[model samples]
Each structure stands twice: as structure tokens, then as C-alpha cells.
Target chain A: MTQTDLAAFLAHSVELESEARERYLELADAMRAHHNTEVADFFMRMAHESGLHLEEVAQIAAENALPDLKPWEFDWPGEESPETASYEAIHYRLSLRQAIQLALENELAAQAFYASFAQSSADATTAELAAQFAHEESQHAAQLSVMLKELPPDDAHHREDDDDPHMPE
Target chain B: MNDVITFKAKDYKSGVKPIWCPGCGHFSVFNAVTKAMAGLGMNKDDTVLVSGIGCSSRLPAYVDSYGFHGVHGRGLAIAQGLKVARPELTVIAMGGDGDGFSIGGNHFMHACRRNVDITYVVMDNEVYGMTKGQASPTTPMDWDHSKLTPHGPGVRPFKPAALALAAGAPWIARAYSGNPNQMAHLLAQAIEFPGFSFLHVLSQCITFCPQQTDWKAIVNERQDAALEDEDEAARLFLHEDGFQTGLLYQRQRPTWPPEAAPPNDPDLTGGFRL
Candidate 1:
């Protein structure tokens, strides 16, 4: 169901940012465990950005009396929030460029999600809030795209075999 | 206004990163568990999670609740003991297919027969993931991946839902980890059920059984309503393909530790006296 009020809209936004932050942190931890420090650091920075976004959403939520929706109660378009990266898209050997691309795609999806809400919301206040969120997400997407351009392209030979593959005998 | 403090799914997480492969379906199972707990408004301190040895067994570590990473195949026994001793605690026993059906197979049968008030979640990946890639009890007979088996285990796979029905479990449900939202709903229902509840989660191990990635397209939600009668449930279970997801059976039965106390015996402590 479409979020019709400011409280419901902010609740969705908070969840979206929080889940994205947690997923990015999880990816960073996994990358570090795999000894890919460069990619790990990149994911960590992305996670930090998500954390800041979460704080911003939380502040907006505090300004309004948000309804506490259970995890299963939200009308998320998918199984999870739009900004959270799909677990299947991550790999232990992911490159820095690929990581940035993943973040960029997530930002684009979040932007689209808020844009749709802004257009479809029935309540005037909800629509205005959604539009503001959508504009912020659009800025984030633009910034990510610019950052993606600065990263070096992935090399064809960069896919190295694990020296100690965790394979069963 | 409801004064209850609501929690998000992340609140149930311990913040420990799972060491499983990046895309392993176990990640979704983890997410589902946390979501279920949050949905139930369950107090983490009052819940206990137990697991046997396997990749899926590492779940307790990731959850921010009371947990026991017990010895291989003894998760059920430990969980049962905990439930009997502290009947107030919500206990959930979990492990991989091999850990639950092979080494702990007998316990699975007894747990069902006893109808204890606990939820057992078996992450059925059909292969032994932690051991690199061995043929598990639920692996299809024709699967020939392991050099050890060379030509597969040459035995029919174990049917968990049917076995639970035969063993007398009060509730049985199947879920796919890829669909975390549905899985979370099923898990919450299982936890709230009065007696023994068996939740069979088809969590694919991408590293060992990469072909199972197609399971996303194959798994169909159960069309028939959950059956209360044993005969009808058994018939529906036998007729459908194993990939069907959703509650298959539910029948209320007397849980263990019956309210009526056993007759007092003077000789009860005689055997224990040295």
C-alpha cells in the first residue's frame, strides 16, 4: 500500500536508509575477511555515507510522530528496501569499481522509489516530503555517478584464483 | 496509542558478519529470522537458539539472542532439554539438512513424536556445505558431484515434511530463503504454534550446489490450504513436488511436560543413590 501520511513516509525512508547502511557494512566486513582491503575500504566509506543518511532520516522521523511499523508491515516494492543492495550481487572478490557501481545502482533505485511516491501519494504533505526525499536521492545518484567515473576500470586479468581455495576434498 | 517499543530487523542482529559465501541463501535465512523475531516482538533475552555443526549452524552467532553452538547433530537434544527445564524460554533449533537428518536423524524423529513446544528450522541445502561439498541425506540420488560418492549416494532423498507428519509433529511448513518476507511470516507463525513446529527452509548453498540458483524460478507457493487431518495432509504432501513452499500441515496436540504430574514414587531416587 502507498504511504499516505508524513509519518508513514518517514518510516519507510528510515528503514530504507538503515537497511542500506547495514548491508553495506556487511559487505565491507566480508571483503575484509577475504583480505580484499581496497574493496573493503570502499564499502566501508559507502556504509558511512549510508549511516549519515540514516541519521538524516531519523531526524526527520523525530520531527514527526512516526508510526512504528513492524519489519513485515512496510509496503516495500521488493523483499527488502530499494536502497539495500541485493545479497546475490555481492562477491568476495568484488573490485572497487564494481562496488561503486553497485552503490550507484542502489542510489538510482532509491531515487526512483521516492520519485514514484512523490507522484502517487494522495496526501499533500506526504507528496511534498516524498518529493524532497526524491530530490535528495537524485543528488546522491548524480554524485555517485561522478564518483564512479573517477574509479579505474576493472582489468580482465584481475580475477585471481584463490591460492587457498576452500574446497572439499 | 500503543506504547510498545517496536524494533527493526537489525535490532536482532549481533552485528557479526556471517563467514558464509557472499551469495549463500543462508544470508536470507538470517534476515528472515531477525525479521520474524522483530515481528513477534520477542524479547531477545527470553529466546534461545541452538544449532548443530554445519555452515547453516553458524546462525546463532549472527543473532543477538541466547544461543548455543552445540556439538554436531545434538542441537535437538540440547534444545529439548532447555525447553523442558526452562519452559518459559522460546527455543528454536536449527541446522543444515545433513546435520539434522543424518547425524541427528533419530533426534528429529523423537522431537516430532514428543511434540515439544519448540520450533525446529532445518536449512535444507541438500548437500553438506561445511565439509566442502559432500552428498547429504537430502541430496537427489542421481546427483554426482563429490569424488567420494563418484556416482552419487545411490539412495532416495529423505522427505522432511512427510517424515515430520509420520513422526507426529503438530505443525509443518516449507519456505524459501530467497523470499525472506514470506519466510519471516512462516517463521513467526511457527514460533507461535503451541507444539512442535517443523520449518523446512530450502536455502541453497551457492558454492557447493550452484545449480540450485535456479530454485528461485522453480519454487511454487502451496496452493492447497493447510490441512488439519493427517491423511489429507499426507496425501497432499505426496502428490506435490518437493519444491512447494508454505504451510502444509497443522494439528494441535498435547505438548510435552503435561500439566498432570507423574505419580510420585519412593524408589525414584533409589537408583541415583550410590
Candidate 2:
């Protein structure tokens, strides 16, 4: 890949990984704030895994001429990527299955993005890297599927305190 | 040739993750600010972030730079003092609507007229999120969700941008959280301006103002394709949709750096004895 292309790819990949890590951390925080200890722990673990992936992505980026893309300059398809859930979307009562579904959807989107990049890129090294990313995302999707299946059905919906100040009186 | 510098948005962000609600618009503003700082290639050590009390005031804690989370409604005063003491530092103040327009209203007015070379970002979320749900200065008159004001405040919302312009603010603009790119660009511009730059950001409290999610659709770029004059900008604001995002006004003004003066003489009582 040309230097500019390499820089763009590195920025793109790092942004993807960083956003994914941020989303997991956000989910963990939201769950914890809502007092859902089990789900919060699960999200925190997932966040750590994503943080590791982010570190690997950053290392890959360091090997290239990555230009610093400003917050507004990132070539992301959306303000943020699919795997990164919106902070407002999560509820304290969210089931583990629901969380898995969100993760699975994000992983699938990431996989699609990587696959498209791999197929379209003319640079052999870039294509190889894209393919590797696609494979990694696929693995994440499969893991989410297993987690989803293992989760027990949710039953305690009204466990929240009725006198919560946030609740409309 | 420009001196090449290295920094990233992540570098500006502190290791601490914000504990705000998931959809709080402050996150986007935080993202935009970091991107702006990175884009400007500002040295972290040469910058100082001062913030007043409230959820948005917590911003300084999350950014990896010299920051002072000051007392309630005192961020502007603190930032002004810091800028005076260390004129070389790039000082910025951040606060919520209530912190800026209510408790700090007097300071806000004086700061604007002072024309200090500092950037002020007011994240107007309409309602007070940190104190649960309370109608704020920027809260719309018809927002009757809060039990405190079931009938709504029924008062005209504070027009921050217009007030800034009227108060002779040299640089003024509005931004939306949903549009991170535009916000970042505006923030950079604000930081680059010489005198006081007041940026009014429409940050939504997602927990209290869930319906404000449509702010993305409502926000549009400024018309006329330029930020020419105050009259034109005010005309655009009054006639066109207030939701339009862009640099609304800019004017060259003298920065309010304190003038150097002779030092005070020693007290006669201490030197000559009483």
C-alpha cells in the first residue's frame, strides 16, 4: 500500500477497535450504574477483551505510517461503528441474551466491513490484513453466539426500587 | 514549514471513562474537544481546562491535561485568573447551562466583555441532569415532565448565542452533539480565535430528554456559506432554523491580558516601625 493508503487504513482500523472498546466499557458502566451486578461484570470482562484487541490494533498501526485523523476526519461509516452501542440504548434490566445479541450484531457488521475491505483492496498486504481482521471478527461473533445460548432466561423485570428518584413520580 | 507534531484523540482523553448516562450528549462534546485539541496540535502541558460544577464540569477530569474542576459557577472566573497568571497557556472553561447562565450569569457577562483569550464551552442540556431533573435556564418553556414544574417553567428559554453576540463576544457559535465532525471543527476554530470564544453546544440529557434524539435531523449547516458579519449572522439566526450549525459570528478584538505595572512599595509600618 502507498503511504497515504497505509495511513488511512491504520487510522480506520484503530478507530474501529477503539470505538468497540469504548462501547463495551460504556455498557459495563451503564449496567453497573443500574445496579445489575452480573451483567455489569460480564460487560466489564468483554470490555477488557476489546481493550486487548484495541492494543493489538494500535500495535499494527504503529508498524505503518498512520496519519492522525482528527475526530471529524475519521472515515467511519457512522459517527461510531456498529459494535459500539449507544450509551442511552442500554437499560439496567437488560438481559445477558440481549447484550449478546447487541455484541453479535456489532461483530457481524465488523466482519462485513473487513470482508469488503479485503475483497476490494488491490494491495496484497492490505488485503491479507483485512482478511485476518475478518476472521477475528467472525470468531467474536461465534463467541457471542455461544454466550447468548448459555444465558438463562430473564425473569426479574420489576426488581428496581419503585422510589428511584429518576423514576417520574 | 510547520513543525510536525504527533498526537491522537485518544491521547487527549484521560484513562478514566465517563460515568455519565449512556446517551449523554456530553460524551460527543468530549470527543469533539479532544479531536479539536489534537487537530490543533496543542501541547497537553501548555493547555489548562477549568470547569464549573455539574455533569459537564466533570469534563476536565476525563481529559488528559492540566485541569481544575472548580467550585460551582466559578469556572470562568478561575480560567480567567489562570490565563492572566500564565498568559502563555491556552485556557478553556466548560460548564452546563445552569452553571454558566444561572449561578454564573454575572461572571459570564463580565467574561464576554473582558474579551480574554480563552474558549468557553457551555453544554446546554436544557434540564439539570446531575441534580436529577430540574428545569434549567435553557430548558424549553413547554417541557413539563419534571414534577417540580409540572406546568413547565412557562418562561422564555435563555438564548445563549444571541446573548453572547449582543454582549460583544468576538467569536460565537453553536454545535450539536450528534454531529461530532462539525463540533470538532467549530471547537478548533473557537480555540484559534484571539479573544473570548463562546461556543453554545446543544447537549441533550438523554435520560431526561430522550425525545431530543431527533436533534440529529434538526441540525443543519449554516446558510449563505459564510460567517460574514454580525447582522447577517443574526438575521440568519432569527429567520432561519436556529438548529443550523456553524461559526455564526466572529470579530477581531483585543485580548484582555493584564497590563504590566510597577510593583507595590514595602509597608511603612514594617520598615519604619509603628
Candidate 3:
């Protein structure tokens, strides 16, 4: 919650990326199991991106005396980490468009979270680091937006019988 | 143990992707379980997750630890037996509303009063999701979404936390899958609780009950929800709607089998005298 301290900032950043990567991988696996290969592959790509960003955060964490914090201890703007996409917005039958949109939304939330710390942190070092992270998140969001724009119109739909197929009479 | 690497939340997963619907709340509950394990640095081999038949019952297969996907509505029974016999293992029983509060309703009540040193997690989506939507024991009296209950079940739903409290459970809590952080925190606390601990989780069955998607906005954490006093907790449960989530009730009680059991009898008829 205290983003002013470099240790706290790094801890939060590391958790945000870690949680994001885990969620994307979970989503990818779920879709893959359901035979939604296209959406699954898209989620895996997003997971790869999250993993790369996580490596950067982990590298920074290695250089600093990062504080150990519980998963629930982080004071995020919402109930979950900013980059962890809301479960309500995704489903196994999700189309490629929805997946890209969800990724973009996560990136935007992460960018806003970092921008908040960049503008409000009392520690100059934390502020500079937050600004750099914010810029990176913005680039990711922009890339997702372009992906969304390029998606074919027919690729943005869920299965017609996406609901249950075996209700007992 | 020294040769073991520290497990993160993901590392606790069994690598089997859950077949739950995309927006189903069980996904988040699964994450919360793994998070709690990682937070406690629990040894996977020493921990066992047990479940009965239901959509949520598939949970055991997703965990990297020892698991028992038992018969319908019998998870708590199996878990209790395992814990009592093993004594050294950590046991957690899990299932959905229909499985726990309906078919296993009797077992649920007795499990609470038995005061076994185990944790019961009921993912209350208020429907029989595996059956493709039927009114569960915890479903509201007037829920008419299912054709089977065209005029509604017209029966008041079971208040799990209240029931647990009345059945003499020492620790009771309510959590929402939408609030994964708090859910994980509560789960860790429940697992560590000495006596019988009951955690009622509001997990949505998005395929059968899409209206439940609104639960994220409806549920709220209340500071005054948890109480150490039995009388006050009963009054609070009577007054509050199910929306209030957190550790709802807690009280210290003597565990049934005690924390650690005596050494196992060598003879099969050793306890026949009883």
C-alpha cells in the first residue's frame, strides 16, 4: 500500500506481474482444454508478454531489498491486482476480440496504477521507476489496441450453444 | 524438505486445466486455495484436498497435493476419516451447494458438531450446476429461473454460517470468489484454525445462473460481521443478509479427536471392545 518506499513499490510491481502471468496462463489452459485453440493461443501470447515483463520486475527486485508481502497485503485500487483481468469478463468460449480487449483493459489498468504511483510517490527513486513502468504499460496497451483493430469481424463471437448441453429433464 | 523448492501459487496446481466455464467463480476459488497453500508454505505431500461430486467437487484434481474425489456429497466424511486416521496430514473438504448443503446436509451438520480438526469449504452457487441448473438447498425461496422450479422452490435457503454456528463449529467464515485476496486470507485462517472450521464461499455458476455475475457488486466486507460471542453472532446472522462477507463467527471449542490422535492400534479388533 505504501508505494513511496522503493521496497514496497518493487514488491507490488513484482506481484502485479506475477499474478497477471498466472491468470493469463490459467485462461490459456482453460481455453485449450475446451478446444478453443485460437483464443487459447492468443491468451498464451499474452502470458508470454506478461512473463517477459515479470522478468524485468524480478530483475529490478533482485537489485533492491524488496519487502516480503502476502498476496492479500497489497493495497490495489480494486479487489485484485490491476493486471489480473477480471474473471467476469472472460469465458471458455471467448472470441479472439474479447481476449484482446481483456488484455488491453488489463494493460490500461496497470498503466493507470503505475501512473498514480509516479505522480504521488514521495520518494524520487520510486517515482522515476513508476514512470518508466507506466510508459511500458502504455506501450503494451497500444499494441493490444492495434491487435483489436486488426481482428476480423467474424472472429469476435462466442459459440452459439455456449451454455450447458446436458440439463436433466 | 531441504531439497524442495519453495512453491508459488501456480506451482501448487496439478497442471490439469479446470473444465469449468470461463466466468465460473470456482476458478478464482481454486486460485485462492493454491495461494493459501503457497502463503503457508504447505508441504504438498502432507496436504490433502477432498471433494464430493459437483462442478466445484472437481477441485481436488486441480491441486498438486493428495486428493480424494469421493462420492456425491461425501467429501467431509472422507476427509474427516482421513484426518482422524492419519493425524499428521492437513485435510480440506470442498464441494458445491447442492453437494454439501443438500445431499450431504446430514453429514454437514454432524461434521460440524463432531468438531474434527479439519476445514470444510462449500462453494455455494445456490444451484445444481452439474445437473444443468436445479434449485439447491441454498437457493432463495423465489428463484424461478429453472423450469423445474417454475413457481420457485418456495423454501427458505439454508444459512450455512448460521447452521455451522448452531451445529457447534468453532470457526465459521463467508467469502466471495470475486474477492480472491480476502478469500485466500480467510482460507489460510480457516486451515490454521484448531477445531472444525467452516468456510462458505459464494461461487457463481455462470453457465446456469448468469444473474450471479452481479454478486461482485452486491457482496461487501463488513468489519462487524465476525464475532467471538455465539449469542451475538446468532443475532448478527439473523439481521444481516448474506451479502456481508468475512469471518462471520468464531469460538474456541474442544476438538473431538483432539489435535493429535493416539498411536494406531496394531490389531484390527483392537477397538472392538468399544
Candidate 4:
């Protein structure tokens, strides 16, 4: 699980972005089910960002022999890829504020993952690559943090859409 | 078709994204299925997803592969026919517990006995999710959440893996939705198995059975390794509470229709082949 070489580290990076993109798309579609179009669109935009990053990493590593590690084989810090949102956090009525906060937290976690590798990896080239990824993740987190601040002060507590969760009769 | 070097789970996904509830376990299963397909390098044009009616039956709509969204409880029958007609294509049949064990119980039994070269996956949520949450054939006898079964179904649930082996399926495995990675691993193996392979997925219907979230802590890996002996597997299934997940049994046999099937009879087939 430890990234001892550049190929392994790049593989992990690609996996992280892939997972993040999938999770965002899931959240967006789930929100759409509850008619939360605004939040859904926001999540879609985040997914696009992740997709772009994933493309860049994949394009460069297409020729490299990235190890095809099983899903459980990945040595992720959390239960899943650092950038993937927690399943417990998903809901049909998730508010835009909560969605943004969740994304921000995931970005921070990804940044931390790359940062730890940058500091602990013994291989100099791998460490440098991890550092670059860490910087990029930090920027993503900062942007999300700003989005969080710009929302209404009470939005943080706005996890669920309305007080009632019952379907209309 | 895709090369291993170009493996991408998203490539196996359709244009529409899955939209299950907040705590719904199907999300994980969906991801696991796509990951498994990508890992196997399955060709979208050659891989077929057949399903009966239910929440899980909607799976075909989410995958980019060829799909046959058939009527309720006929998934196995249809999938078997498809695989027999086109032996070269990879066929996967999937649906909910209600559809597979109740309405299609007869077909399920025969599918196991016939030993067709296809995969069958049952998303056993233990409740009829699409019909607003009623106790399913696999619902616990003690479960009393549904008003219709407020005092509990008071009926023993169908033991899927045990039943599969009894009916003569060559491969049987149980997987938990809480562990998508493990589910994906098992799925790839089941798909590669060259005979009737049944994978029972304990997918939680969080919208109705919110308590199922606790399955994360309750479910455990099987204590014993994969068993090839039917009697040993039977004894294992009989004693366990069915919370254990892993490859419980495998006994490959020559697939059905030992030779190419004869020309289809329009009377029986109605000239409608999958």
C-alpha cells in the first residue's frame, strides 16, 4: 500500500480522482431525485473538476504500468479513497451548504493524504510528485472553504432540506 | 473491449448516474459491479445484464453493457436462454430477493440444476422495496417493521446459498454491500466461473430498513475457507446465522446443452431469442 515508486504513487492518485468523480456524480443524481437542482448542479461542477484532474493524471500515466490493485488492496487513510465522500453523509435532501462542506472536507482529506506521502515517502521523485498533488488538493480545499464561507451563516446546520422527510400523500 | 492499461470504472457506467437513498446499500453494489466489469475488461457490446422487476432490476439501466430488463422473476430463465443461444457473450442475471425466491422460485431452482454458463446475482434487501417495503421471501421471520407484517412474517426465510447448492448450482457466494471492494472481488470471480454461479448480495433498503445500517458491524467474514464439498458447505450454512460473507461453495460441471442447441422451434421460442 505504501507508495515506494512513482508508478504506484501515480496509480493511487488516479484512483483517488476516479473515486471522487464517481461519488460527486452519485451525490448530484441523488440530490436531483429530491428536486434539489441547485445543489445537484453544484455537485456536478465538482464532479467535472475531479474528472478533469483524473484525465490529466491518466493521460500522462497511460504508458506506465500501474499496478491493478484490488479495491481493498489500496492503503487509504480512511475507509475509502481520501477524496471520496462518506456513504453515511449522503441523502436525497442534502442541502447545498452541506454538500459544499462535505466536498471541502474530502478535499482537505485528500490534501492531507498527499501531504503525508510527500513528507514520509523515501523516494525523492515520488515525494516531489506527492508534494505537487498535495498543493493542488490544497487549492481545491481553499476554494471550497471560500464557497462554504459565502453561504448563509445557518447553512452549516442545513444538512437535510426541510423539517419533514415524508413523501407527499 | 478495453485494455488493462486503460481500465476505468466509469467506462462501464451509463450516461445516467445511480440515485439511491442516503444510506441505501445499492450505491456500493453499483460501484462494485462497474469496478468488477472494468477489472474483467468486459466488452460493453458482448456483456449482457438481464434482470427482473425490483430496485435491483434497475441495474441494467445503469450499466453501459447490453441489457434485458425483463418482467418480474424471469431473469434467470431469460439469462440462461441468452447464454445458451450466444455462448460467446458474458451474461449476468440480477434482481431482488422477492423476484428471485418467490415469484421466480421455480426458475431459480431450475437455473441452478441446469448449470448454464452465466452469473446470477440477487440483491437480497429482504423487503419488496419497489412495492413500498413488504417482507420478502428472505425477510427474517422476526422482522416486524412493515404494518402488513407487524407481528412478523412468522415464516422461515429462504436460505439462498444453501438452497442454491441444494438445487445444484456450481458456485455460490455471499457478499455484503457494506464491503464494495470485497463484493467486487467476489463478483469478478463469480463472473469468471464457467457454470451457474449465484452471488447473494445483502443489499440494504435504507429507505425502509434503516436498522440494516448496523449490518456493517454485525456481518463477519466466514470462519472457514471456501468449501468444495457440498455436505461440508451445507453443515456450515445450517449452523451459521447467514451473516458471514465469502465464497461458500464451488463445484464446476459441464455446462448445459453439451453441444450447440438445435435450431430454435418457433412454437416454443416464438422466434424471440435473447
Candidate 5:
């Protein structure tokens, strides 16, 4: 990998963190709309943590002029960036524990992504940076796991029943 | 790249959380629309989105731009009027399959024939998700889950792309929500085209039609290249399955509000005074 490759890799890293933040914010909004304030607040906190990660990535990016790439140009192992949460996995009645679990899964995926990149990169600097990023993602995942354990056991049947359904009367 | 103002996809969002169900395909479409708008370097103030009643109609609220969440099935009519009144604005009309093909079916046809310089994006989820799991105009003949249609709708589904082609729309295309980047590219191209453009998006309703989650496996890129000839387009549309996604037809045509007349002209109504 060359300087250009490193810049591209950093750009992707920045995007992954940014997307994760955005996705969490969107989930928080969705939860609020569903009148689930408890879960919404939890999601908001997760989003704030993701924002801190984004700032760190931005600080690194400030050290180098990252290449501007289109949303489609990034070569992710999956259909989208590794840390971006799946939109389909959200439910209006989702529990706080479930939300944290989802974030934990995304953090683990991000960790795995960086680990693979570090192993595959031939350039020493790129490999070292990837390893460092992987370590940071592992820490985030560990923190989320601890947060999940602190939450009360989720009751699968604790969903609020709508008095007036949206179905045709 | 000199003087090019770059924008990220998130910059186009309104920051208002979408209330759409988790796993809903509309989320991808929303993301794609914003990406397309940003890719075009469109001025948020100069762009407007209009939509009728449906789950997909909520798209305008999520996009940070001028929008109108109009009455049920009248999104196209409102969009056309706005486009005519303010031709400089980039007007886009969006709704679900039921809103466009059933209640607002007539407006859909005329909007295409009128050739207004507006883009219409119909998120076809087959079933009416907003009103629970009811069969919509695009629902398959064999979909028999609805109590109202215990034996299924038993009618042929509406073919949106072919109908748009027949109705004189100059640009017609289909995209899948499963591939947001490709959808964004298609949307950008549709917006740039100088005629009435119909973008049919195969967005799935995960709650009502959970089986459609397999669309990621079923949808395929169009093997045949985009057709510039009307006859060739018609042949391709008629023969191919609806799962093929890409620009199917495009042709240069005269748009509405033909060159404006000089402002100094005498009032034509003066001669007709009674």
C-alpha cells in the first residue's frame, strides 16, 4: 500500500464510524417516534459514543488529506460499511438491551474488518494503523458488552400494545 | 475537479428520524434519494419533493428540502402544478404502488403524457403497508394472505414501467432498494434528464410482506442495455420479468410550457370579452 492507499483506508475508516453514528441517531429517532423513550435514550447515548469515535477518526484524517470517494467507491467486505447498523433489524418495541446488543454486534464487525485489513496490507504503516484501529474497536465492543450486562433482563413480552391500530377498521 | 463543491450523503438528511419499521426497504430508498441529490450538487432550496398518502410518502419529511405531503393519491397532480408554476425548481413526486396506481392512477398517466420536467419515484412494495397487510394494485395474483382477499386479488398486477413507456414518458427506469448506490446513480440520471422521468423502485414492505426480503437474491441487473428506441424499449419491457433493474428506456422529447411568450403581448382575453 502507498500513501494514496493509506489515505483511502483512513477515509473508509472515517465513513464507517460516521455511518455508525448516523444509524444510531436514526434508530433513536425511530424509537422516540414509537413513544419508547427508554430505548430511545439508550440509543442516543450509543450515538453520542459513536460521535466521539468519529471525532477521533477526524483528528487522524486531519493529519492527511483523505481522498474524496463516492459512497459506492469504498471496497467494503459487505454490501455496506461494516459498522453501519442494519435498518431491517430495528423494531418499534425493541428493548434497551436489544439496542445495546445491536451496537455491540456492529462494533465487533468493525473490529473484525480492521483486523482483516491489518493482516492483508503489505505496507507496514497501513498494517500498523489497521491494527491500532482494530484495538480501539475491540475496546468499544468490550465497553458495549459491559453496558449490556448492566441493563435489566429484557422481557420479550413487555411491548406496549397499541389501543388503536393502524389497520383498516 | 476545480471549483467542485463536494457533499456527503448524510448532509442531505433533515436529521428527523424516520418512523418507518425496522428492515423496511423505504429506508434504503430514502438514503439513495439523498445521495442522488447530494451527488448532483442540487441546491436544497431549489429542490422540492411531493408525496401522497402511504408509508413511502413519508420520504419528504426525512429529506432536508422543500416538500409537500399532499392528500392521498394526488401527489403527481400537486407536483405537476408546482413544476408548471415554478419551472426552475427541481420537483420530484414520490409515493407507494397503491397511491400511484390505484387512487391516483389517472394523474399518473396524464403526468407522463403532459411531459412535465419532474421526476416520479414510486416505491413499489406490492402490499399496502401503512394500512396493515392489504393487497395493492401491484400485489401478485397469488398473494392470498389478506383476509379481504382470501383468494388473492385474482387480477394481473400493474406493470408500471411498460405503462409509463406506453403513456409517453421519455425516461423510464426501475431500481431495487437492496442496492442503494445503484439506485442513487439511477436517481441522479433521472433528475438530469430533461423530460418526465418515472423511476419505479422495488422497495419491500418487510412487516407485511416478509417474504419479499428475498428480493436481494431475486433481483438481477438488466442484461440488456438501456434502449434509446421506443419500439426496442417496448419489446424489452414486454418480454423481460420485472426483477431486472436499470434504465429501460430514454428518448429526447418536447417538454411542457414550450418557450415562454414575450411579456409585452396584448391580453388575448380582451378580444373575447362579452
Candidate 6:
């Protein structure tokens, strides 16, 4: 699909960030449903952080017209937000460190997606904007790595609960 | 800025979030469906998805399109009727292996034979995930995981793709939730197809069927490029040892729509009853 006008692209970036934030919040809710309080709290923290990033993206709009993209209109290669996809692949019994690993993987993928756009684009302005987005994603990856490093060591024997009610007995 | 306000896939999702178990594969199927719809630039108002009773049947509630959560095993019948009446609209039917094959088994066969212009997405988790857990039609024989069927349902399991093909379905394919991009592409193609299209998605029911979580690894081992020839596709589909993933067959067939006769009763007036 052709990229929309500059202002719309900017708005789309903001929406993309917002989607990330919303996805984090949804993950938090899912963790709570599974009664994984620690994981839920971690996702909530990530949601708050995403919310702050979304605010920064919104600031870039500055009265520019943001194109309206329907849920199906975004040119994302994946189905949903990067964070959402990573979160869906996680289990309820994951530790904080494992959650952080999942988050880091997503951040790296997001960074790569933006970097690809930045490096492949022929338009100077588009490439510049993509580069800026890539840098932002890089910072997220670094931050997640630091958080992961601060976690306590985990026992190799620690395994998740095998009997989920949803599973057939 | 002058462009009309476009909605993203997120916008199409309903406020009522999915109650499906976290890590369930249906979420991926849902994501693929919405993504395919978004890729097509379909008007939400112009689209309708109907589903029967089951865990996978809840798909309609998650999307913002016109939806009908019909009774158990009756989704195809309702969706077909709706499409025949409103040929201008895009219609889709969704359900699980049990709902589509067990209770609604008869409808499943005829819908393919009728050749209605609609898409049917069956989230085949093999074992029924809803109502706790039960042996489904697609559950393998001699693989008993359920307390209800202590030694498995020894009868041979139903193979959806083969049945669809044998039943004369014009479009038949198998997809795995682990490969969302390819599944989304198949869904898009199925939606655009002229006659009955069956998309069998191997979704994991993480809560009830933990074994399915490894389906990604299993599915990764099987990938065939889309085939353009029917004879070649038939050979690949008919001779396969089961467990392949790709568009198995696609054939052009005349779509059956509702008769164009006008309403004749006086009760067909434009006014509504007070």
C-alpha cells in the first residue's frame, strides 16, 4: 500500500505506539486473569512506559492531519502490534525474567522492522522518519535488557503448572 | 490529512475482549482474520461473520463487523441463507471441529455441495476445547486424553480437507495459527473465492489441549508452495501423509444465490409494527 501523506504517517506512528500501549495493558489484564500477580504487575509497568512513549509520538503530530487507517488498513506485516504477538506466545507461569525476555524479543523485532524501513526507503524524508523510529525502538530494547539483567537468578527446575482447566484432561 | 478517517485492525476489535485462555491459538486465528479483512479494505458495515457454538465460534464477538452467534452446529446454514439473501454483502462462517462436524455434520457436507459464495473458517483444535474438554470428531483414534473417552474414540478421525474436497467444495486449504501471515493470505483468498471455501486452521487450545502448543514445530516441518494445477494439487493433497499446510485446491464454480423474486405479501410494507 502507498504511504499516506506526511501528517497521516506521523499520526499512524502515534497510533502504532498507542497500539503497543494498549497491547501491553491487555497483556496485563490477561496475566491478572491467570492470577499471575507478579507478571501482571510487570506488564502494567510496561503499559505505563508505552503510554509515555505514545505521548511523545503524539507530540510529533503538532496539528498535522493524521490519516485515519481502519484496523485492517495499517501496512504492518504482522497481524497485530509487535508486543501483542510476543505476549500471545507467553504462558501464564512465566517468571519476570522470562517476561522481560519476551518483551526484549518484541523490542528487537520492532527495531528491525523500523530499521528495514529506514534503510530501504528511497525518499529522504521517509527514511529520516523511519531512522528516528528505529532509534526509539533501539532505546526500548536496551532498556528491556537492563531490566532483565537486574532480575534474580531462576532455578532450572522451576516449571509452569501443567494442568490448565482449558486443557483436556 | 484530507483523506477519510481510516480504522486500523485494533479499531475493528470489540470492547468485549476475548475470554479465550491466554496463549490459545485462536487469538492468532482472530488476528489473521482481522488482518486479512484490513488488507482487503472492506467496509465493516459491508461484512458479516456468523459462527456456531464452541470456543472458536466466539470469533464473531471479537470483530466489529456484523455478526451472528448462532446455535450449535447451525452456522453454515445461517450464513448460507444470509448470503443468498444479500449477495452484495461479504459473508463468512466460523466454528470448531466438533460444532461443524459432530452436531452440524450434515450441514457441513451439503454446504460444500451447495457451493455458496462464502468462507468457512474452522479452528480445528482436534479435541473440543469448550464445555471443559471432550473427544471431537477430528480427535485421533487411540489417542485418548479425555476422562470421558478413557481409551480414545477408536473410530477413525474425520479429515476436514479431504472431506471438503470429496464433498465437492470449490476451495479447500489448511493453515496453522503459528503461521499467521500465510493463514491471513489464505483467508483473503478464500474470502475472494466464488464458491464455498473451507479454511481449516490448526489452532491450539492451550487450556484444554496442551499438546497442540507444539503444533508450530510440527507445522514448520510441513510447507508446500501454492499449486496452480488441479491435477498436481490433487496428487499432493490425496497422497500426503496428513499434516501438510498450504492451499490444497481451488477451482472456479458457479455461486448459488437466493432467487430474485420480489416479496408478495401485504405485510412486506416498509413500516414496522409498533
Highest DockQ model number: 3
Identify the leading candidate in terms of TM-score. 3
Clash totals for all candidate models: 0, 4, 0, 0, 1, 18
Worst 10 residues of 5 chain A by lDDT: A160-169
Model 1 clash pairs are none
Runs of candidate 2 exceeding 4 Å displacement: A1-4, A91-95, A149-161, A166-169, B1-7, B14-17, B221-226, B258-274
lDDT of each: 0.87, 0.80, 0.88, 0.84, 0.85, 0.77
Model 6, TM vs. native: 0.80
Error of 4 at B217 (Å): 1.9
Error of 5 at A73 (Å): 3.4
Candidate 1 interface RMS: 2.9
Model 4 steric clash pairs: none
What pairs collide in candidate 2?
A: A87-B22, A87-B23, A88-B22, A88-B23
User: How do the residues A1-169 of candidate 5 rate in per-residue lDDT, one tens digit apiece?
Assistant: 2332678888988988887888788778778877889888988888898899899988988898998776766777776788887755666767778888988889899999888879888778878889999999999899989988888897767754554222332
Per-residue CA lDDT of candidate 6, range B1-274, in tens? 1135455556668777777766777877887887787767678888999999999999999998999999999999999999988888899999999999998989999999899999999998887777878889988787567788878889888878777776778888888877666787789889988889899888887766677676766664245555656667667666765567777777777777645677565576544546
TM-score of 4: 0.85
Candidate 1 residues B1-274, lDDT tens each? Answer: 1137666788899978898876678888998999999988888889999999999999999999999999899999999999999999999999999999999999999999999899999999999988778889999898787877778789989989989899999899999977777899999999999999999999987767777878888998887788999999898777667899998899898999788666476677865778
Q: Chain A: TM-score in each candidate?
A: 0.91, 0.85, 0.92, 0.89, 0.89, 0.82
- lDDT over C-alpha atoms for residue B198 of model 3: 93
Chain B alone, candidate 3, TM-score of 0.93
Candidate 2 vs 3: which has more DockQ: 3
Per residue, candidate 4 scores C-alpha lDDT tens digits across B168-241 of 99899999987777888899999999999899999987777767877878888776778998899899777778
Model 5 DockQ, alpha carbons vs. true complex: 0.31
Off by over 4 Å in 1: A147-153, A157-160, A163-169, B1-6, B261-274
Q: Tens-digit lDDT track for model 3 on B1-274?
A: 2136667788899988799877789999999999899888899999999999999999999999999999998999999999999978999999999999889999999999999999999999999988778899989898887889977899999888788888888899999989899999999999999888999999987777778888888998978756899899888777678888898888888987855565497675877777
TM-score of 1: 0.90
